[model samples]
Target: MPRPTIEDVAARAGVSRALVSLVLRGSPKVSAGRRAAVLRAAEELGYSPHLMARSLASRTSHVLGVMVSDLHNPFWAEVVDGLDAGARSAGFELVINTGGRSPARERQALTGLLSFRPAGVALLGPVLPASAFTGASAHTPVVLVSRSSRVSTVDTVNDDGRAGSAMAVDHLVSLGHREIAHIDGGNGSQSAPRRTGYVTAMRRHGLTPRVVRGEYTEAAGAAAVRALLSPAPPTAVLAANDLNAVGAISALEEAGLSVPGDVSVVGYDNTWLAALRHVSLTTIDQPRAEMGRLAAEALVHRVRGERVTPARHLLPPRLVVRATTAAPRAMSGL
Candidate 1:
């Protein structure tokens, strides 16, 4: 069977080949009804524009590069969905790569994506230094998600990490939890603000703050739990993220402790995993999809030369209560 072409789409939609071309190119001149017809026809005929051919013919790439820090996390997948939707609507496609949460690997991934000469790049929770973004922006537009930048050429989209952490602490405190410990996301993007917020909230409540060194991984969360147990665990625990919270729960269970009974637990990032029936984790909700969409919009604006200064989007975070958090049990050892 032959592959469907633009001609086939036009014939199926009862439109001229030129009109189909215009619609495929995302020309504003096409009426909404005609554009919808052409798109529907293309979908029915399984006709996709050859991106490489189109780029070569027009000498302009419609590809946007994306570098994600951790592919294992479900949060990034949700964000990528929004990014793909936004980019495709703007007549661009995404070329994505992962850095395994390593700065060196992220630098390499960024360089590899830039080698394609894409229209722009969006870094999702990148671990790379500011210098790397500066260097990349010299060649193409760069937008960051879940990260911050002061460089005039780079744009950033982030949730309020400080406020999110503070909300978690306040919630736990309101539940009559006096002894609370936090497992921190060490060296990760936006980790500092979260740590600061945890400490500040604890001090404001007239409680001693206990912070454990950990990374944004389950293993780190488990290890931190073990360390805290030896020194007498707190009545409540604040995990770095959803994955970390799950790990902390597992470790607690292994030690004959029940979640929200023996020790209440709170997590950051209200990801899909947090909503599972078996793992109904109380968490801080970041607008993951909205952040991705905003990042894409920023890059698109830069690519189109519509803005020059910078786009700094700091979205608010919300608290999502679940089964994992509860008031401390009477006679619970602190």
Candidate 2:
């Protein structure tokens, strides 16, 4: 059987093949009614896209594929919003996928995206190795978010994790917290920088630093808190991220402890969950959406042949004080 083509759909919809092409590419030039007709005709005809031929003809791929490490973390949603908006404004469409935060799975997801021959790819908080990213960049323009790269071929946008972690420690210190513990973002993107920053800040403050290993999930955070019940728990904890921090809260409550009274907590990313009226988690805001927007802009610059030197953007993070942080009870008198 002959496969349906764009011409078939165009004929069925009573529109030009060019109009069908515009509709298939999600071009803004197509009228609403015509777009609906073209889509409906294509659906009825089961016409699959000729992405390869279209890509080769124009030498302008309108598709941008994005791979997010984890969708469970609300932070990625905001970042994706910025990327989507930026891509659309610059005349590109985005399709996104997630690996749920596994390096192997991330590599697979990245490979699948690259196979589509997108104009470029945006990797948000990927856990894949540097070599993997570099290899992919060689095939297509690659912009990495929340990961650093020495290769000038790959552009990167990241919040300075070291500074952000240090800022969290400083906030705790200012609140008179000396026995603070850190829930490390184990093996996650930029986790090492944060862990190192925590250690450095503790040494600078003349205080002992303790680390709890956990992944970037609420369950891991809760488990870490449960494991900290012995050996005299620290007065407070700085969690890896907002999702993890919320899990820590649940665990702390389960352990018969009141937050900000018995154990203060701080989270990272400052995602929407942290800002909720109920969560009100003190956290480090990483300008996540801005990072995504900047990443898109950087990738577009390459696609447009504007910048040859890789764009490396390092944005600062800020500490947001919320209901979760308070002066240590021991020093309320001071």
Work out the TM-score per prediction.
0.86, 0.88
Give the alpha carbon lDDT tens digit for every residue of 280-302 in model 2: 99999989779889988988998
- Candidate 2 colliding pairs: none
Model 1: per-residue Cα lDDT at residue 162: 92
What tens digits encode model 1's per-residue C-alpha lDDT throughout 20-125?
9889888999999999999999999999998766776667889999999999888899899889989988979999999999999999999999888889999998
Residue 284 lDDT in candidate 1: 98
Q: Candidate 2: what lDDT?
A: 0.91
> Highest TM-score among the candidates is held by which one?
2
